[model samples]
Target: MTTPDSAAADVAAKQRIIKHMNADHHDSIRRYVEAYASKSMFHSRSAQMVDIDLNQMVFSCGGQQAVIAFDPPMKAMREARERLVQLDKDALQTLGRSDIPITKFVPAYTHPAHLWNFTQCVLAMVLLPRQANWQPGSLLYDNMLYLVPGFASFVARIGWIVFVYQPQFQINVMGKPKLALQVPVEYTIVVFADGASDSLLHGSLSFSNVPTQCDFQIALARVGRLEKGKKMKPDSASRTLMGELGLIGSQKEQKREQFDYETAEKLCVCSVGPPQESSGSKTAKCEFSLHIPSYLPATAMLPSVNISYAIFATCILPDRKVLQTSQDLRIVRETVEPIRLEPSRTVYFPDTSFAVRANFDPPTFSSKNTTISTTLQLYGLSLPITNSMRFTETRWLVPREIRWVLEETAVIVTGCPDTTGHLPMSSAQRILKRRKLATGREKLKLRYPFTRRGNTPVSMHSDGSGFSVPLTVSGPKDLSLDASTALSVAGGHILHAILDESNSDLNELQWRFAVYLECGLHIWLRIGEDVFDEASGNLVNRKMDEMAYTIVCPLTTSRTVTGQHDRGDQDEPVPMIPPSYDQVWEQPPPEYATPEGFTAAEAHTTNSLVPQDLLG
Candidate 1:
């Protein structure tokens, strides 16, 4: 007598031996022969092969073994039918809670023998059944099926499954026809096709230790509810009987014909009235309008935004074709933010550029050539500051005025806002990261500072750093200049230059123009080219400077422009040379009076690619 424990031990021993034999590298041919001989004997239905050598080896020695499934054809059918009925019950219970009600479970019989033969190529024991239900006034139907997990491992039916019926199998001793089944009698296991025809349903569920005989009541909510049902077909809608059993089908058929016989919707017919003819030539005029919101801050003053625009126009026609034209147009708008006047100064609009774009459809386009033209205008302010009414000075108003064109390009910007107090030195370092002023050699020739006449001496002083003086304009006027001025510094100081001035105080005033110009350049460079770096918030208050310069330049432009004209009208002012602002600018604001807390501009790291003279 084989006890469950003995049977399990035998199976485990066979499995161990099979695994060992399979792992042995006795060559593929030898392995195949041994496998075939051993597997065939175990699978043979004849009892004669029960004691065969291969079978004995598997039973006693081989570590691995295969299982022989025994599911009689008649028994398979009966279980499948039972599963189908169970599915009908489950689905009815599930769908019935909704507006839909079960009408019947219709039996559908197909040639199981034919299906089984075809399933030989695959595996799956399946039974399909139709389910009928009623909706409001209509009868709805769906098809569902049950499948023995492993029997239909390869067999699949398309589009027929609406639910699955899983039934347990056990040997019946007192039954009329005793038969062996492939399923365990413990669990209800089911598998849906999931769009495949050759899928197996076996071993999907092992019996769980849940109480099977608990007298717990199962309300309608016990089963999962079906998704909302689709609208009933017009052919299925029904009507009430009048002295006769009027069928839903008849009513649906009548309604369907009524729907089919309906006339086509009457064409919308109100007349638009004949198109009014025009006497003049059909020369349609297209005027493009651009409306920029006032929110855009000015660029000249602090916290200002200066915008320049360029427009590229394109016309798309009825036939998926385009006619395009592009033009660069500069737009200058003053800052809408209010300004508080401190000294005397106004914003200046240097000749700059902006961007714009336009679109036109067929009606706006013409086969005849059309032209687009663009022009740029800059506008700003001018404010005057009252001096101590000092002694008068004399200078030249020459056509070639001794002007200092300190051309600086903003290399980068770290968009940090100013804090309530002093910014840490680290803030400046981040803004200046990776961006070094172009060396004089790498910068274009026309962009650098060189006197039109003889070479002029150039001196630069940043923060409290000593003047790099008398770097005599010793080279040729056209000669490219390269300066190695990365003198290490202690803190964040701004870039400033001193001209050949007699009095240092007067000299400081002369450099204001250059400082503002550098500020403008920096703003554009940082806003357009650099990433927003926050760590650089403490150094020199970088972000607020940008904002303040932008606002002040544009907001006070009217005063500045006026002052420039007024100064121009007066007798030629002295050709004031640049002055160093190392002390004043580098000085910590009154709020931050610590003498050592000077914010020195970052040392212009040498970029061999950029010319040093570019910022001269």
Candidate 2:
């Protein structure tokens, strides 16, 4: 039924598809065979599409033939590609998987969407207080808004937080930096009191910490000077107070480690909204970014240090009273997951005495990637050539197992507290998975040992012939109630936020991968090394498969470079919508010309439910 010309074209098309799939979409072929043929091959790794026809597609999954029939046969080769994508989608859904492809990625957008409604509300409250119709009203008739009757009275009584003609401000982080951020100050206050002098919105960021202690070293010293005409006995168990003199020896003097209660440093001073009334602009937008760089000895609260950031703002009211507020700034640090993968991605996972270099299936990897192809290889486990094992001619390992894990390592770094003798430290960890490379012991041949000594760093090399080992790490899975897993720069990982639930760390501490305090793929080998037995206090040859070699595999990520995103439209003015009748009462009509009710005539004062001021 088929013509010669058509058959030739079809053959060429089939070859192209096979080559492409085998080269790039090996996982897809494996999935197709599993979805269309059998779920039994789900765990089996190897998959290759060997043949295809109009009626059926054949593949080898895990060394077994899997034939999948095309119920509606494709009329042409071009249709094959489209149909395959659809099949993959269906297969992914059916198998509870995601379309998150197996590929390397780069950065993407960061900030959240703007709250236009809230923005308009704050702008109205500040720029047009008296004309604006909300919670606060004119200073004169503000108390009487409840007497007459209506919706305005309801809000006035309940929303007592905002005061009439009062100014309020809050500091928020606009963007994060390596060790700094754009501390954008937002103002939600009424206009400066009429004829108020020296009306400047001034503030400063202050740093405070516990007492600074000097670094000391332990050394042997006689305390004969402290003990006059008496011999002091040394307590072998005493870690301190050795023979009546403190055993601590002062080393090279370092900078003061912390601050005292009496001593506080103002890290940076900030003037919100252009020095008070510079341009007479009601909407006091913060044009300057408060950059808190990590240069000072007491700056940015570097990890393990106990410095705290507090924002202090001072304002003068009409009566010349200075009103000030100070709130703690939650400084969050993000861990750097920087990885470099150029034309080649043969990355080395180093350990003390062991090392492994792996070339991934996609030749690149990040937290966004799902799985690794069976092309992994390990090299050497070099140890220091110490005196004990100097004559060791050969090296051997029982080869316990290889484990891939998704682990979260958290630390609650307590700051230098005011009181001493308190060990300020806390930590917690959660493991999502611990996938093993084998179900039983691995049998391998003994080979020549690798050794290094004296200043030459170990674990930068590999000894054994590394081969591709099966790795089964996949995540960001979808389930109804399952908690979220980690992602990379490309995968929209929040990276930093206030913890939703209370944690043992700090009350509001949250971080990821800043310092060694990061979570990601952790791989380790359960192999034995020669160590002296503690019980016998002698060298023992006994081997045990305890966790020895570990490599916290850093995630390689790629990000898309994008211009300034989420820039609100400056051209369009926010439309002020009048309140409905449901929010108004018969006694006093609702006002719209202002957010603050600073009306000159008492008649327009609408906050009063009763006409108390008008009748007076």
Candidate 3:
């Protein structure tokens, strides 16, 4: 029954779909082949979409072809994008992974605030290699480290290693989008009663972020150990190796290694090969990179989640002695999506003819009370001039008011997931939701919201134009709103100075950064939805309760990082307004205030403690 035209349309649509999937979402294509198509041939390395139809998609995975059909074939071409997202979600769940597009790891050492810390780290690196402790059974191993305060925390690992070299860290992209961590380390083996166990370098990772710190445990590069499925045991041998030599330092250090190996047996590892030892070094030296699997929920603090990664270099001796040292890992996520330079959106009412276009100045925001230059253009407002009577109609449509609302949705994760991937009792709280700009109805035809713009002489012109310039709305040849009519118009919004963009930290508590930021713009129009006039094909409007509801604008927000470089400036990080979502960030705090406890003098203190932001 299909016609030639319909067949051609289908062919074109399939080609476009295949090209997009191969270019942007190859990860999904790989997953599709592994999950639905060939399991052994592809090996999840790479996949390309060669062709697609309404019912199915054909992929070439690792030179192997796969045809994955839709459940009930797609009826239209536009449904392809949404269908792919759904399929990706299913693929991720099946692959036991999450959509964590972790591109790179960022270290805090580059920041000026960590200068003293970095200096000490450098000092430790210099002193470690020159000392006897870097040698096994030197007894004096880490003896000097104890004399200094935080030095032991860096170079010392518990187990069979005596002297250890402070490592230099770098990130190598194993394949595209994989952050392979490379660390160079040198260590002297501890000479036991029998002999030094075989030395192997491994790493474990943990991280934490806002509202609370999340205790997600992850182990990395556990190479050259017991068989892949076997777990590490904490025995007297691990203890004597800690106590007998200079290896034993703290009780906390002893339990961590055993716990990491036992609990994180199923942790994802992209590549696991024995460390390549260098023949040139005096000590057992190995320089290797670990291709850490993406989205491994770490422990410590990151922008998305406050989490840190650790390394556990273990050696199972002939006597089963284990050696190790761990440190806090600092990592930052790379910007995946580019920031919009000009966030211009148009709002159209299907029942009306006049369209309202909104333009927000790019990335003009503050920690609180951010002032922005905003403009709303009114278009398609007219009644046609008559052919015979030649009567030109002139009328005005005015905006009643404008306002701003800021919302914060905070999410908190609790216990580890069960076998079925169900959380025991994780929750989130809405910490802040308040209106930064409040507007009330005015007797004037046009009510323009006004606030200060940086160093500009005036934020608005007499005719309500921005930057103190004269502006005329394009309309009838001789029509113009006067200075008084335009003076009150505010094309921009102010994120009240007291308002804060969502922050990602609170020390000690086990919380993850799950707070999302959003803005709601309400434009109250003096004119309601338009009505059609049958005579001249013109649209007119009748008045209703204008203040009852508002036309909301979807706005895009970004953060500005100011740098004072000697020359120009460093490349600032892209501002990310975490995607708006309603998730539990924290368990709701217990209500402590009672009539007797609530007093006037303690008001300011109470305000500081409680999230008293008014509901928007």
User: Whole-model Cα lDDT per candidate?
Assistant: 0.22, 0.37, 0.38
Q: Residues 359-404, candidate 3, lDDT per residue (tens digit)?
A: 4443333344344445545554443434433233223333333333
Candidate scoring better on TM-score of 1 and 3? 3
Query: What is the model-wide C-alpha lDDT for candidate 2?
Result: 0.37
**TM per prediction:** 0.16, 0.23, 0.27
Top candidate (TM-score) = 3
lDDT of 2 by residue, 127-183 (tens): 343333433565423665445546555554544344343333211111111111223
How many clashes in each candidate? 89, 34, 59
Query: Against the hidden true structure, what lDDT does model 3 obtain?
Result: 0.38
Q: Any runs in candidate 3 off by more than 4 Å, and if so which?
A: 1-261, 265-285, 293-310, 341-345, 348-355, 360-375, 378-401, 406-616
Error of 2 at 562 (Å): 23
- Cα deviation at 459, candidate 1, in Å, is 25
